[model samples]
Target: MGLIVQKYGGTSVADAQRIQAVAHRIAQRYQQGDQLVVVVSAMGNTTDRLIQLAYQVSPEPEARELDLLLSTGEVVSCTLLAMALRAIGVPAVALTGAQAGIGTDARYGRARILRVDPSRILSHLREGKVAVVAGFQGITEEMDITTLGRGGSDTTAVALAAALKAQRCEIYTDVEGIYTADPRVVPEARKLERISYEEMLELASQGARVMHNRAVELGWVYKVPIYVASSFTEAPGTLICLQEGESMEQRNKVVGIAHDTDVGRITIRGVPDRPGIAAAIFTPLAEAGISVDTIVQNASVERLTDLTFTVAKADLRKAVEMVRHVAQEIGAKEVLWDDVMAKVSIVGSGMQSVPGYAATMFRALYQAGINIELITTSEIRITCLIDASRVEEAVRALHRAFQLEEG
Candidate 1:
């Protein structure tokens, strides 16, 4: 019998009925003789509701306490799931991230997994018990509770799979599978049967929500195969693995289009363009854990230049404050930011080897009358920041331009 690791998102076990349904699915797998380890997120909007409750009591909650509060949501779901499994006559036990041997650095809201001992989980498995793990959280070196950021459950599952040397990691979520584009945005978007790890990494990083980017990164590094499918359906799902020796001519040059509406752009206008200026402004944001994306610097006119970058909208206030402080120190003019920005990207491994992908993407956006505020590219992706209002249009235009629907 092979060992398997599975992760269920918040939606899959949102309530009593859903939790029971998931238990049945696990029971079936267990009955088939495969040892199972399950990782689960907080139920439904439990994390959000908890955050709201915390803010109601305090404007800025303490990070350690907030993490401790947030971690309970997953614990509740996991225990309920364990009880459900036992009710169905399946041997099961609930374990928190720490009990499951997940250790992390003390980053509080965004901790990174440092190690997984897996001894406790292995004991449960040996006893013919399913180990139900609370995902998204772990213990710090100091024994304080810490949580990985949003979608951290995915990381937890993949990390466990890697440590346990499971045959495969299955991620059960609300969506049927990974699509050419978000089907809600593009009606004709097709589901991909398989995708390369590199392609999936780019898609997830570019804002595809089906899989967490960090999880994909871990899966790639460990060479672990991940299966993504819906928890509510029996439909065929997508397999993310290494690229096979297939005819290059048979593959689509553009694998998918990803868009993010949670974009915030910051422009530091009239900055003195000089060595160490960019570092001076961006170093503090990095130390503050604010992720900056799609930076653009205009040519210096009279030794003065404009520097622009994008961050998540939720981070706009803190990012701007940090930049403004740096701006004054660097003798800059004004710090400006726009919260209503969106980015749409086209991603495929073969795009860089082809000549016309960029021109095609730009032409499509131009034809759709979407103003391109800024542009960025990697070896396999091209991202354009545009007015949030025009994001859907931009995605559809690019999807059609890349002919993704035909697949």
Candidate 2:
């Protein structure tokens, strides 16, 4: 058997018992004669607790310092996992991101992986040892520690799989697999047996929590297969792949519903409708490393228009401050923002060729009496920004409208 790369989320190895269980699972693969490389996240809520502690000490902790503090969470988990495996008579060694030769650009909390020099990891595997790695944290050229924002562990696992040419990358989490809708939000939502990289990417971007979009992109680019399953169960899970075959039925079906509540909207009112105006308003935001989503610009009336867009709710304060400066720089009337809105979206690859997908989605929301504040669309995704309070209702309605329940 070839090498296999496996990643366990925080919940899978939340404590000593769970760590021991995961170690046994890895031992099974090793005993079967397969080389294994394992990636582990922090224990449950450890990262959150560290962030809370940082804030308790400082009003605004420095990004570089925060990265240094948060990286310890994964290191602790990795070392403990290695210890667990060794105690059970399996050869194992834990390595930090730097120790594994995972190099990334210097972006602090949301750094991007520039390259992965897997010589150290390969060496460990060649020694017939399970190489345990600390995920989500990497070293930059400046030798500063950086965290890969949210869901970085998943990225690490896939990147290693691609670099090592592993047989497969398995992501073990709390859930069985990706579903049409969040199981908590829609009781009728069904787990998918397989999903395409394109569809998974759309759902991940729109707010599916099972996998991160960045990780999916890495898998797609490397043409690596990813399997998602629950660490505690033996049941077969979903496989995210290039395609499920060329079937017309699969081409035009609504695959999933994704929603995001951690969003904030901003509107720049009374801005001049000029060629460079849009770029001028958004350039500063990009420079500040703020990601903008779902942008809408009203048609000019009397040579003025309003530009509205969305950002992560956590960045609302910083975004507002930056936009306010741009508003004045462009001589706009004023800048207004709202953090009480959430985005709900339905994604399917078949949407591009299928008419009425948008209409059906709109009709479902209309029947539910949910007012849509903003709307955006891609070939396979239709997203509506609605009052945050109505998101659950909207998701339920859409899930029912699409008939996503298992037969």
Candidate 3:
């Protein structure tokens, strides 16, 4: 029998009924003689509730203690799931990330996985027990508990799959599968049957929430096939693999539209343009773990230019604070930021080899009266920053422009 790794999101096992349903699903697979290892997130909004409770106790909790507190949410779900499986006569055991041998660097809130020793999991699997592991967390070198950042559970599952050499990694979530665009935003957006790793990577990075970008990156690096489908449905789902078939190749140049409303733009106005200026402004943010995206520097007029970049809305304040001192040190006029910005992107693998995709995207946005504030491009994707209020309009317009509905 082949070994399989599966991950259930918080929504997939949100409550008692949902947990039981997931147990039954796992039982069916177990009965078929496949070795199963399941990774699960904290149930429903438990993580959020825990964070709220922590803040109530203290305005700013210590990161190590906060991680220790946050890690319990997944443990609670993991134990409950194990109990459910046992009640149903399915052999099962729960393991926390550390107990399961997930080791990480001590980054606290955003720890990175360093290694996974699957001996404990393998021993349990050999005994015909299903290993239900807590996702999104691990132990540091010093044995302190650490939680992976948002969507860290996905990273956990993929890492385990890679380490265990599982046949495939199945990610069961609330949505049916990966779609041409967010179905809620574009009514006619179609679900793709398959997508290449490169394409999916671009889509995930560009803000398609079906899969986390880090998980996709791990899957790509490990060459692990990932299946994304709904936990509540039997409908056909999407397979993320290394390549698409000839039939899929016949589709339009643009395969999907990805949009993120979590965008915040920062503009350091009237900075003296010179060597090392960009580095001076961005280096501190990097060291602070604030990711800067889509940087644009206006052509210098009289050796002065406006430099702009985007960061996650949640990190906007911290990013501004981190850069303000540097901006002044570099002789800048003012540091300005806008949190009401959003990004929309069109992604496909072969778009760079062809012409006219960018023009079509720009024309569609222009026609919809959505002004493009900034632009960026990769080999396979084009992203535009726009007013957050018009993000839906821009997505719909781009989807129709590229005719993704018919994919």
Candidate 4:
């Protein structure tokens, strides 16, 4: 039987009773003759509470000290989970990320998993012990505890799966699985039984939040099978994998629509459309670590062009300042910032060869009474910047237009 690596979110094992429930589920899987490795996040709200505590002590807490502070959250979960499994008569061992040999870069926050040794894990498995690892954390080269950014637990799980060459990596979250669109917005959106990794990457990047985009990219690179399932239900979740040789050729024509509500548009007005002007305007924003999406440039007249792009609302100020600075230096007239934007995207492995997909998307949005502010397209995704208030309605309309849900 193939070994499986499963990662549970904070909500999955939040309290003592919840931990006991997880133990029962794990024990059943253990009885199935499959060796198991479990990764877990901190208990619900624990990390936030820890951060709050740190802030109570100091408003500008040192990063290194903060990492030290936050790492304890997962340690508590791992130890408790191990105890719960043992109480259920299963032999299990809890390990910190360092103990599990999760080696990452020296970055304090948002560090990337560079490698996994897992010798300690293998030893435990050989001794007939299940191994539980703390997720979203790793030890740096300097032996410093570093925290991965948001949804880092998913990356931790996927990284371990790649390391151990496990049969598949299961991400246990609060949601059932990948949907045509977020079910909260599009209630009729169906859970995708199987989704291509590329499509999932687009979905995550567009604010799925169920999984992080970097984790999906790593899975794609490592050819690891990822299963996204709900922790609270028996419903089967979505399996994300590489398409077969031929499936790649036909799968991307039209897939699913993804939408994000946290978008703000920045327009750099009256900028000279000259060499390095666009670069100058965007370079500082890039330096400030903002993810810009849906970039558009209107036709330049004489020498000036209007440039626009979307960045996360959280980073709106930083992005605005950076661009405004560049605009001043370039003698541009003004910088316009619009925070009322949302992104609606359709991603599929099947769109490579499809013609008129753009027209199809436009016609659907038109019928839905949605106005598109900015438009961007790639080989597999067609995205639009629309009014943030209408994001859900636009997503539902697109989901229906693409027939992404079952009848």
Report the lDDT tens digits of candidate 2 across residue range 376-403: 9998899999999999999999998988
Query: Which portions of model 4 miss their true places by more than 4 Å?
Result: 245-253
**lDDT over C-alpha atoms for residue 35 of model 4:** 87
Please, what is the TM-score per model?
0.98, 0.98, 0.98, 0.94
Q: Could you tally the backbone clashes for each prediction? A: 0, 0, 0, 7
* Model 1, residue pairs in steric clash: none
Locate the minimum summed-lDDT window of 10 residues in model 2.
243-252
Model 3 C-alpha lDDT per residue in residues 1-407, reported as the tens digit of each score: 69999999999999999999999999999999999999999999999999999999999999999999999999999999999999999999999999999999998899999999999999999999999999999998899999999989999999999999999999999998999999999989999999988889998888899999999999999999999999999998999988845553553368799999889899999999789998888888988888887888899999999999999988999998988989879999999998998999999877777889999999999999999999999988999999999999999999999888876
Please, what is the whole-model Cα lDDT of each candidate in the order they appear? Answer: 0.94, 0.94, 0.93, 0.87
Q: Worst ten-residue run, lDDT, model 3? A: 244-253
Cα deviation of 215, candidate 2, in Å = 0.5
**Residue 61 lDDT in candidate 1:** 100
Which tens-of-lDDT digit does each residue in 1-407 have in candidate 1?
69999999999999999999999999999999999999999999999999999999999999999999999999999999999999999999999999999999999999999999999999999999999999999999899999999779999999999999999999999998999999999999999999989999988887899998999999999999999999999998999998888777655478899999888899999999789998898889999999888899999999999999999988999999999899999999999988888999999886777799999999999999999889999988899999999999999999999899997
**Per-residue lDDT tens digits of candidate 4, residues 257-314?**
8888888888888888789887787778776667787788999998899988888888
